[model samples]
Target: MDDHTALIRATLDHIHQGVCIFNKENRLVGWNQQVANMLSLKLTQFRVGADFDFLFRRLQDELRIQSGTSPASVLAWVEDRGPRPPLRFEVRQRQGRVFDIFAQEMPDRGFVISFTDVTAERRAAAALRAANDLLEARVEARTAEIAVALADAERANASKSRFVAAASHDLLQPLSAAKLYCASLADDTLAPAQTEILSKALNALNSVEDIIGALMDISQLETGNAPVRVGAVDLGRVLRQLGDELHPAARAKGLDLRIRPSHALVQTDASYLRRILQNLIGNAIRYTRTGRVLVGTRTDGDALRIEVWDTGPGIPLAEHENIYKEFHRIDPAANTGNGLGLGLAIVERACALLDHPHGMHTRLGRGTCFHLTVPRAGLPPRDAALPAPEPGTDLAGLIVLLVEADSQTRRALSGLMERWGVEVLDVASGTEAAALLAEIDLVPDAMLIDAPVDDGHAGLALIARLRAQFGQVPCRMLTADCTPGLGADCVLMDVSLLLEPVDPAALAFFLASARVSG
Candidate 1:
C-alpha cells in the first residue's frame, strides 16, 4: 500500500490536473500536490482532517450561492445551466497568487481539477470591451454634430451667394444714376444754400461709393478672387502716407491722425500690406468720433512690426475673435460707414496668406490696438541722392473746363480746384457745357467731366463728342466708381482719368502730371 501510495503521488504530480482519492463514503483518503495548490493549501495542515466541505463552504460564485458541497455537485450546478463542457473559478489559496480553477468528473469515481493564472487574459478582455464602448460613444457624438453643422454651412453659403448677385445688379445701377445726376447738378448756377445742399447730395453719393467698395472687396475676398501680389513693402512709407492722407479726414471729424516712426521694413505684398493699413485706418477713423487714431511701428527681433491704435468705443474681450468672422456685424443698425463687418476678416486672411503673426489688445470703452509681426522684406540699398516732393506753383493760371451733373460735387470739386488756382468753368452737365461752348468762343486748355450718370458714371457719348470737337483739349474723366483698369480705360478714350471725391491736392497733382504727360 505504501508503494501504491508512492505510485499514486508520482502519477498525480505528473498529471496536469488536481488528483484526489476518496472512498465510497466521501472521505479525503489522499490528495496530490496539484489539488493542494489548486485548493489554496493542504487543509489537513490546519484541521488535520479538514475536508472538501470546509473549502466548498468558503467558495463564492457569480450566482451568489453559499454552501458547502461536493465538487461533483458544484460541477453539476454549473453544467445544469447549459451544456457547459468546462467550469472555471478562483480558489482561496494559502498564497496570494490568484489562480483559475477547473473541475471535471473523472472516468472512474473521483474528480480531476486543473487551475492556472488567467489574470492577464481576463484583464485584456475587459480592456478590449472598455475600448469598444468608448469608440462607440465617440462615433455617436460626432454623428450628432455632423448633420447640424453641414446644414448651417450650406444655408449660409447660399444666402451669401444670393446677396452678392443682388448687390451686383441693384446697387450699382442706382449708384450709376446718382453719380450722373450729381455731375449734372454741379454745373447748375445756384445760391450758396442751394450749392451747399447739392454738395451734401454729392457727399451722400461718395458715402454710397465707400459702402459699395467695402462690400465688393469683402465679397471678392470670400470668393478667393482678390489679386495678391507679393513684393517688398516699406512699412514706414505706407504709415506716413496714411497719416498724411487720413489726417484731414480725422481732423474734419475733430480727431487726430498720428503715426509713430517705424524702423523695420516688412517683406510682404505691398498692395496687400497697404490694404491692411487701409482697413485698419478706415476702422480707426470710423469708430473714433472723439479721440485720436495712431499708427505706430516698432522692431520685433528679425521681424518688422506694426500697430494701429484708436481711442474710441473699444471692443470687449469676448468679442475679439467673433469680430473677425466674415460679415459678422456687431451693430445691427450701424449708421456710420464703419464696415460691412468684413474689414477685419480681410485683415486676418491677409496675415495668414503672408505667414505673419498677428494679435490684438483692447479695453472696453477705452481703445483698441492691433499689431502684426511680418518678415522683413529685405530692403534695397537706398540711392545716395533722393529728392522730395518739391514745392512749386504748377497750377498758377491753369485753365480747366469742369463738367459735372451733380451740383454739390461740383461745388466741392470747384472749391478744391479753385484752391489749386485753376480757373474752372463749372457746368451742370455735358449737354449744358456743349451748348455753352457753342455760344461762347473761349476755349479752355483742359476739361474734366464726371463720366457717369444714370446711364454711366462716364458718358461714352459725351466723351466721344469732346474727343471729336475739342481734340486738342486734355479731357479727364472723374467718378466715384473706382475699379481696376478704370484709369486705363480713360487713357484709351483719349482722356486723363481721376477718382472722384477727389482730394484737392491729388486732383491738382494729377492735372500737373497730365499736362506734363500730354
Candidate 2:
C-alpha cells in the first residue's frame, strides 16, 4: 500500500492540471504538489486532515479577494448555486495570471477540482484590442488635419486671383496714358536721329506693355476668366492683318518677312488663334538675325496646319519641353527684345484651351518651324466687318467731351485730341463735366468716358446722368476690365466699350464710327 501511494503521488505531480480532492466529511483527503503550488500553499500547511476551507482560504488570499471576505463566505456562495455538478469556470489572480477551474462530483459524495493556466491567450487578445483603438485614433486625427489644410489652400488661391486682377487693371491705366502721349509725340517734327530714337523708345514701351498684357493673360487663364469664343475664323483675313501689323518690325531688322494667304476657313476662336500666331511670328522675328520668317498654311487631312518658319538659332532637342514653361529663356542675347519669356507659355496655354495639337521641329544652328493643327471649318470664309476710316487730318472742330479720373490719362488724351484738331472738353470728375457742359454753348459731338473715373469708383451712374442730360449723345466707354458682367452692363447702357491700353488710332476710328451711326 505504501508503494502504491508513492506511485499515485508521482503521477499526480507530473500531471499538467492542478488537482485536489475532498472527503464526505468536507476535510481535504488528498492533494498533489501542483495543487499546493497553484494555491500558493506549503505542503505541511495543507495537512491530510485539514478542511476544504483551508484550500479555499489559500485561493482567496492569492486572488486578492476583499480582506473582509472569509473562506466560509466563498464556500457558501459556491454552494448556493446548488449541488456542484461537473462544472467549469475561470479564476484570475492579482499577479497577472489566469486559469480555467473545473469541478467534478465524486461517487462518494465528495468533489475534485482542477486548475489550468490560460494567461498567454488572454494577454495577447488584450494587447491587440489596445493597438486597434490607437490606430483608429491616429486615422481620425490625420483626416481632420488634411481637411483644414485643403480649406486654407483654397482661400489662399482665391486671394491670389483677386490680387492679380486688381493689379493688372491698375497697371494698364498708366500704360494707356504713356501710349497716347507717344502717339501725340509721333506728330512732332524732329531730326532723322531723333526720329529713330523716338521709334526705339516706342518699341521699348510696347515690350513693357506686352509683358504686362501676357501676365494678365496668364492670370485670366489660371482663374478661368478668359472665355473662349469659337466661331467661323477666316485664316486668310487673320494672316493678312498680322502681316499688315507686324511687317514694319520685321522690315526694320532687315529680315525678309512673308505671309502666304490661304482662303481656308477654320472652326476656332479667332482671337485665340490670332494670339497663338502672333506669339509664334513675334518670336520668329525676334530671334532671327538675318534670314526669312515665313507664315503660311496647308491642308493636312481634315485639319489645317498653320506654320511659322524662322531662320533663328534653332532650339535643341533637350529644350523643346522646357521652352514652354513661364520665365524660361534659352538665350537672352539671341534677341534684342526685352520679353518676359512668356510668349511660348501663352501659346502653350491657348493651344491647350483650344484643344489644338501643336509642336515644333528644329535643328540646332540651322532653323526652326512651329505649327498648330486647326480643324477645318468646311464652310466659306466670311468677310470681316471693317470699321470706317478715321480722318488723317480732317478731324477739325470735332467737339469731344472726355471724363477721366486719372490725371495722367486725362492730360495725355486731351493733348492728343487737341493735336488732331478736335475740340476737347476734359474734366477729372462728373461734377466738373456737368459744369463744363453748362458753360458750353454748343453740345459736344461725342462723350468719351473712362470707367472707374474716380479712384476705385465705377462711372456707371455718371454715365446714366450724362446720357439723360445730353439726350442720345454718342458715348464710348474705355476700361481695362473685360469681366463678363461689365460687357452686359455696357450693352444695357447703350455705350461702346473699348479695352485699354487705348490706341490713339483705334480711338479715332471708333469716334468716326460713332459719328456715322449718330
Tell me the TM-score of each prediction against the true structure: 0.47, 0.59
**Which lDDT tens digits does candidate 1 get at residues 21-95?**
533223356666775655555555433234555545554431132235445767454334333354456543343
Please count the clashing residue pairs in each candidate, in the order shown.
Answer: 28, 0
Worst 10 residues of 1 by lDDT: 382-391
Look at candidate 2 and give me any clashing residue pairs: none
Off by over 4 Å in 2: 1-150, 192-197, 219-278, 289-306, 349-356, 363-367, 373-407, 417-499, 503-518
**Model 2 accuracy (lDDT, Cα):** 0.76
RMSD (CA, angstroms), candidate 2: 8.1
Tens digits of per-residue lDDT, candidate 2, 1-518, equal 99999998899889988887777667787778886676666888778777776557656757743235445555763454346657666667877777777777777767777878778887898888898889888888888988899778667766766676677678888888888888888899988988898788777777777787677667666765466776666777677556644665687789998888787888888767877888999999989998999998888999999999998889988899999999888888766888889999989998999999999999888899999999998776555433333344367788899988888988999999898788999998889999989887557888888887222226666778887888878777777664434543554455546556776655776566556645
Q: What's the CA RMSD for each of the models?
A: 13.7, 8.1
